[model samples]
Structures are given as C-alpha cells and as structure tokens.
Target: MTDLTTAFERVELPLETPFTISRGTQHTAANVVVRIEDGEHVGVGAAAPSRHYGETAATVEAVLPELLDVVEEAGDPLALDRIDARIDGRIGDNPAAKAAVRIACCDLAAKRLDVPLYRLFGLDGERTVTSSFTVGIDDPERMGEKTRTAVDAGYTVLKTKLGTDDDEARLAAVREAAPDARIRVDANEAWTPREAVDNCEWLASYDVEFCEQPVPAEDPDGLRYVYERSAVPIAADESCVTLADLPRIADACDVANVKLMKCGGPRQAVEMFHAARAHGLETMLGCMIETNAAIAAAAHLAPLLDYADLDGSLLLDSDPYEGVPMPTGLVDCSALDRPGTGARRA
Candidate 1:
C-alpha cells in the first residue's frame, strides 16, 4: 500500500437550456468533484446527484470527507476491492458520494497502469455504441425544435421526456421532426399503470424504441402491470438502482438502466450488467446532468451497455474537463489518446 491524498469541491454547471422531466425542471446542475492523488498521478471523478434518488450536491459534499478518509486510510489507489468494501461499510447510502470516490480510485489506478480505462477492463475499444441525446420536456413545438436540433447535431438516437397531459402531441412533434431517429420515452414514474399501458400503445405507434420508468418505483406490481400489457418495451431506471434490484425488476421490465451514481461505481455497474444479463434483461447506462469529469468515466462502459444515454456533459453549456469524444453521439472509446478515463482539464 502507498500513501494517498484526497480532496473535493463543488461545481455548478449551467445547462445549455432548462431541462425538464415528469418530475420537474432545472437550469443548472450541481456536481461535486473528487480527486485522489498518489504522489505523481491524480485521479478525477465527480458526483452528479439526483433529488429523485434522495441526493443533492449538498448531501454529496457533506458525506465526501468521510468517504475520502476511507480512501486515505486504505492508502492504495490500486486496492480497489478493499477500498470499495470499506467505502460501503462507511456509508450504506449516499451512493453518489461513494461513486465519486470509486471513480477517482479507478481513474488513478488506470493512470498508474498507464492504460485507458476500457483497456484496463479488458474491453474491446472497437466495440462501441452511440449515446442517445435527450430532449427534455418542453412544449410540442419546442420539443420538435429540440429533436431537429439534436438530429442536425448528428445524434442518431433521442430520448424524450413525456408523462404530460399532451404526451402524444409532444411525441408526434418530435417524430415529425426526426422521422429516422430512434426515439425513446421516459415517463419518470409519472404515470399510473393503466395510463402507462395506454401511453405505451401510442408510443409504439410513434415507433418508440422503449418506455422508461413508466410507473412509480415504489409500486413494483404497477411496473409489472404496465410491462405485461404495454406495446413497447419497458426500461427500469428508478426501479433498478442496485444489483439487488435486478432480481426484483427482472420480470417487470425488459431493460435495466444502470447509473454509476446509483450503483456506487464502475465495478458495481459491471456487476449489475452481468446480473441483468443473468436475469435475461438488456443493460443500459444513463447519467444525470453532469460534467465531463464524471460522464467521461461512464463513457468507457459503453461497450458493456446495450443502450447508452450518456449525453449528460453534452447538455452543459461548458465543461471544464474533456473525457471521451462522442462525435455525432458515437462513443469512440478507441479515439481516446490518453489514459485514465480520458478526463483532462479542457
């Protein structure tokens, strides 16, 4: 084991536009960035918290000192297994905080090994997936405009926010704007089972690829009800937070949407992906509105994902860091020229 040093800071990132979902809206994202250093190398990570998951930037900031203490005590950036276990032991919740520490450790470890994060995981950098750019909830015309803008930006897939009274209108506008784009919808647990079932029927008519979190996570049966009756495939975001959720949500939804913040870290996300496959579920990776400091690390996991919604940093008005390059929404991990998750000061 070697000596390790750690620190954290909070950064507020403004979005290019106000982002809205079934839950609410925000014009800025609050992220807490973590750094772990081992004499020569600094590993970077950030926590993008969600109110829906009971975390905010304040919560992440409050818990990080204790989490960083765990890393310092472990004293070895490469000792991920020990550090990860100790972190979980320190805080059973506060997943975003834990994730920040985990991501930093991985980044530092990869830097020490002098390899790209994907190469460290023995993944094929050539095997890639295009991330879906999101169009947050807006008026029908605005939604159409956003869809057209994303398509013009070369995003081949788009996920739009729905669950409004005028969901059909919103979707129709988006489809009309990007007829060839693969469209997906996320209701964000805003609909009841019956409403979700009815919505999915029309969602399929609009050629939606899937419907995400149609019913509340609190009501597992309601999710299953919608899944069993819906015309489109169902993806569980709120319902599938950790590996334990895989078994419970396996029969209820077809896709398991894993977020690094929700799962605690990259390792945990890998576990969830394999577990999801075991349960006959497709795997997807989603992100909160975040900085490239965070989203860059998640990009390395693209090969493991059946679908990637990692456009978090792309939504930012500006990012202080640059990670992997996603030209036209294609996550080109192989194009990463440097190691350590490809995150560097921009």
Candidate 2:
C-alpha cells in the first residue's frame, strides 16, 4: 500500500498575456498547487478563484491551510470522497479553491494507481476537446482586431463578451472579422428579458451559435421569456450552479454551463451534467480564469458535453501545468487517451 501525504504549494505564474473583461482584470494567476505524494508516485491538482465568482487570491490562500488537515485526515483510497462529504458547505470557500484540492487529490491517487485521471473516473482521456477563446468587451474596432487575431491563431470557435453598450456593433464586427468561425456570446447576466430577446435576434442574423445568461440568474421568468423569444439557443451560466437549479431552468435554457468551482468539484459537476441531461438540457463545461490544473480536471468531462467553453487557460499568458493542450475552437476530443488527465509537471 502507498503511504500518501498531502501538501500545498503556492505558485504565481505571469500570463503570457493579459485578458480583460467588464467585471475586472487578470494579469497573472496566483494558484495553489496541491500535491498528493504516496511513496513512489505523486498526483497533482490546482485551484484558483475569479473576482467575478466572488473569489480572490487572498481567499484561496486563506482556505488552503484548512484543506491541509482535511487531506491528511483522509489519507486512504476513499480519502477524497470522505473529505468532500465532510467539507460540504462547511468551508465557505470559493468552489474553485475547493475544486483544486479535490483535483490534486484525485490526480495523485490516479498516478499512484498508474491510471489517468479520466480512466479513474471511468473515462477515456484520449479524446480531442476544442475550447473557445473568449473575446472580452472592447470597442468594436478592438473586438474585431481581437477576433481576427484569434481566428488567425487557429481558434475555430469564438465567444464574445456582450451585455454592455453597442452590443449590436460588437457582434457585427466580430462576425465580419471571423465569418467562418463558430461564434457565441455571453452577457454574464447583463441583459433584460426583452433586451435579451432583441439582442438574440440581432445576433442570430450574424450566425451566432448561442447566448449565455442573457439575464441575471435569479430571473427564471426572464430566462423563460428570452428563451421563448430568442432566435438562437439559450445557455444557462450563472443560473445553473447545482443540481437543484437544473430542473427550474429546463424550460428556459437549452444548455447548462458546468464549472468545477461552481459545482464544487468534478464529481459534483458530473452529477450536474447527468441531471441537466435528464432535464433535456445540453451540457457545457466552462472555466473561470483558472490554470491548467483546473482546466485539466474539467477537460476530462469534455467528451460528454454538447458544447464547451474551457478557454480560461488560453486567456492566461502562461499555464503552469502541462497536460493536453486545449484545441482551438469546438474541440473534437478523439485524441485524449492518456492516464490521469494526461497532466505532467510543467
């Protein structure tokens, strides 16, 4: 039997570039890398928080020390499961931070068993997953320039940040710049029920694939109104966080965006996906401004989703871990066959 110990390390990685949006700014990612060392093998996991999701570097830093005890206490085959159950709603910590700890423990366990993360979860990681590169809210000219740059860089799917002024112009400019690429938009809960319908109609004219969270998450009536009125598909982001919220959103959304942080961890996310599917909603795996560690864990579920927006790592200037590279645009996950999410030390 492997003798495992849990340890945490802080890492600050400068973005190869900076990604800005309406909510705030992110220049570098300060992540807590969790390592599960069991005698000869080691498994790693990472986690970070986003300001939009009400998380900060300081919050993650504060919570990680508490996790150290949880990990040490549950040092067995079912350690992660036990730890997850014990910490449920008890941590008051950001979902992303907790997810990182869960992922690291899982990764370490898989490595010790000589299996890939996906395989441990009964999945095949040798699948190709395309992730969308997000283009944040900028002037039409800048949006167009960013669109062109992403398209030129081989991104086949593009998601534009909407919900501010001149949304129509922004949509038009992006469509003109990347006419052949798959396009989607996220309002981040910025649109009104009527405005969401109107804008969806306008965006549909430009061949947009869908629009995410057209209204605030609390407005299921507004979501239903927009869903019935809009020309394009509606995807629920902030509105669908847990399994309990899935059924309430069924009529209002055609898809549910799943994030590890929001759902607590991959295990919960997978459960949410199944629940969403049962409600006739498609699943979309998404990410906050996280590193490859979080992205890697989420990537394991890509093959099961109808759409994905896991481009959080690409927005980073540099990702600290090495796993499978996120393919540009609508990933075709037919190539991920490695063990334990294919994550390697970077």
lDDT to native, each model:
0.93, 0.78
Give the per-residue lDDT digits (tens) of candidate 2, residues 1-346.
3366877777787765566555555678777777777676666777776666787667877787777567766666346668787666458647877887788777777766777666677765455557788898888998899999999999988899987778889888999999998898999898889888888878888998999999998789999999998899999989987778898999998999988878778888988989998988888998876677777878778767878888777777777676655555544334545556566666
What are the RMSD figures for all models against the true structure? 0.8, 2.2
Which residue ranges in model 1 land beyond 4 Å of their true spot? Answer: none
Q: Give lDDT for model 2.
A: 0.78
Scanning candidate 1 in windows of ten residues, the lowest lDDT window is: 118-127
Candidate with the greatest lDDT versus the true structure: 1
lDDT assessment of candidate 1 = 0.93
lDDT of 1 by residue, 271-338 (tens): 99999999999999999998988888899998898999999998999998998999988999999999
Candidate 1 root-mean-square deviation in Å = 0.8
